[model samples]
Target: MVRVLFAGTPEAAVPSLRKLAHDTEHFDVVAVLTRPDAPAGRGRKLMPSPVKQAALELGLPVMECDPSEETFLAALKATGAEAGAVVAYGRLLKEPVLDALPLGWYNLHFSLLPQWRGAAPVQRAIWAGESLTGASVFRIIKGMDEGPVLAQSTVEIGAHENAGELLERLAQDGANLLAASLQGMAEGQIQPVEQPQGAYEVAAKITHDDARMHFNVPAFALDRQIRACTPNPGAWCQLHEAADALEPIQLHVAKAVVAGADDESAPHGLKPGELKVTKHHVWVGTATDALELLVVKAQGKKQMGAAEWARGAHLTEGAFCD
Candidate 1:
């Protein structure tokens, strides 16, 4: 059995940890590594990472430290770990640490090798309207996700699937792939292949400014943007009214679809960024077509049906979104 050191921090990595720990026939998880406790929730209390919580429940040892620390290598060696399995550990492993694992370390990245190889793979893939994407198990090299691939599994992306939804699906599917890859490697049934060299785009982390919805873009583009940012940093736009005499109100848009003849409200003919609120629906104009908002949240308010919030705000005819 392979003595594995598993490193991860988020809920997405929980299944991989469980997979290795439960499969006693092929693996023994010596310890789990994760980032230190972080401030979370409304009260800002320091909370253990999901991986740490899961590790304790599994009765496994947990190490909260970064790879760059001088003592990290010694602490890792003390666990008697021969190999490492990493998933979203949020740091780079280098030099002595990588060499300490005689069998080498493997990382599970949420994108096909050589594509979307960075922090926000799932979000960037959906934002770019990629029709298909996958997970890869690769050797952890010095550069960011620039290692040879050991295994990969592909999945199709739904037209309207948000980043959060797609990531949830990948997290579960990728767990099975990671376990199988490790098993295959031990049995000498798998080999690593170098990634193709080319000018591929990297998946940089998305910021609040990057999540803002620009109405001047086409409706389809805006639709993708909103879906990509859903449930995190969330897609937002500003509401500007001619007579408000105040700064524009920020609105978080959760769901929307491009307007078509088949839509309930047909041919809005509204100017770009113009917002029209009716009894049951809210539509915002875009470069190519109108977008019907299904859900939204006003600043400092709970998320609700777009029309419900619009009714309370009493937006004037000239109110627009930017």
Candidate 2:
């Protein structure tokens, strides 16, 4: 049996941690290290991390440690774990912990490394108009997500996949990949491959400022940005609810694609932020192209089809959307 130390702290990390918790025959998960619970939701209640919840349910010792501190180092070393596995732990592990694990620590990152290395991979990937993104299991090194990869798998970037949906799909795929990587590690068949050097893009963690969509952007860019932030912040644009009354409307651009550019000199004369509604969907005009909005939510309203929003709300064609 291989003694494993697992460090994780979110819903994204829960699947892999649950996998380890059930595999008592193959993996002796001596301790589960996770971040402390913090305020969450509308009431701002302190919520336990999924890993912490799962670890306690399984009767395993759970350690809430500051990732930057050495708070759990002694307890971690006491486990006699030769290996450590991390998934979305939300903090960088220090050199001492890495050195303590003889077999080395492995990280299951959401992106295909050297690109989207930071906290927000899926959201940033979509926001950056990336055609594809994948998962990677790499040996933890000093640099951020610059470690050599043990295994990787790719998935197509669906035309209008939102960050939340994409993350759910990737979580399952990553769980499978992590299992395979662990098997290879035990058999000594897994070899870390060096990361390539190139003009890689960084997926900086998405912020409140990022959720603010600039309607002046090309339709394609605005569409991607909307899809990227959907189900969380929901793409928003400031619009007038009535005369002299500016209301910020949050619309979920649930579907989109590259459109309208037939040639280099194609004509796009539509005024940006111009809104149009079809029988089935709502189309928002952008600087370069037009985006088809699928789901939309007005202030004090539930999310629904764009056509529904058009029907319920008295939206006019000449109405301005900032």
Candidate 3:
């Protein structure tokens, strides 16, 4: 059996851990590494990482660290690991730690390397309207995702896919692909291909700022941004009005479609950034077209269909989004 070390964090990494633990004939996972527990939610209570919770259930040893700590490097070496496997580990490994393992570390990245090669590949791919996206098993290099590819598997992104939905699917798909890569490695059939030079773009991690909708851009771009950050820092904009200090009414738009149809309510001459809200919908004029919001969540409320919120929202017409 191979003594493998698993390093990852977040719920997306849970399925991979479960697969490794339960499918023990193929691996001897000596240690699981994850980020340290941090305060979360209402009471600021401490919460363990999903990887940590899964490791504990399997009765496996787990190490929580900031990844930059010297102690963490020693912990990694203590595992006496033959190889290290990572999936969404959320931190870069130091050189000493990488040298400790026999065959070097491998990463289960969410995008086809040399494409979206940074923190938010999955979201960037979807938001940029990529029809195809996949996971890669690559040998880790010092540079950002600039590693030789060992193996990869592609999946089709749907026209209406949301980031949350796509991530859930990729998490499961990644497990199957990583397991297969390990098998190939064991058979001495693994081959690493150098990534193409100067042909990639960084996927800056999605932030609350990235989620804010800027209708001044093309409608297509705005539509992509909305789907890419959904169910999290959901793509948002201001609605008609606010009560306190002109508090910008935060609107979390979930589902949207680009439309060009001209009905009586469509704001024609009002340029981009203009918002049209009625009892059933909120449409924002964009550079090329108008984006019709189907589902939305107003500030301080649950997510509801745009029509449902609009009925009670009383959003004023011609309330331009700031």
Displacement of residue 163 (Cα, Å) in model 3 is 1.5
**Best-first order by lDDT:** 1, 3, 2
Q: Which lDDT value does model 3 have at 108?
A: 88
Cα lDDT tens digits, model 2, 1-322, are: 7788888887888888888778777788888888889899879999998889988998989888675666667777788888898998887888987888888899999998878888889998888878788999999999898889999999988777889888888888898788678768877998889999887877787776777767787777787777888766667776654445555555444455435556332224557777665566566667877666667676667777777878888776665477
**Whole-model alpha-carbon lDDT for candidate 2:** 0.78
> How do all models score by TM-score?
0.97, 0.87, 0.91
Give one clash count per candidate, in the order shown.
0, 0, 0
Which is the leading candidate under lDDT?
A: 1
Q: Which has the higher lDDT value, candidate number 1 or candidate number 3? A: 1
Query: Which residue runs of candidate 1 sit more than 4 Å off their true CA positions?
Result: 241-243
Query: Against the true structure, what is every candidate's RMSD?
Result: 1.3, 3.5, 2.5
Against the true structure, candidate 3 reaches a TM-score of 0.91
What is the Cα-based lDDT of residue 192 in candidate 1?
86
Q: What value does the lDDT take at residue 284 in candidate 3?
A: 73
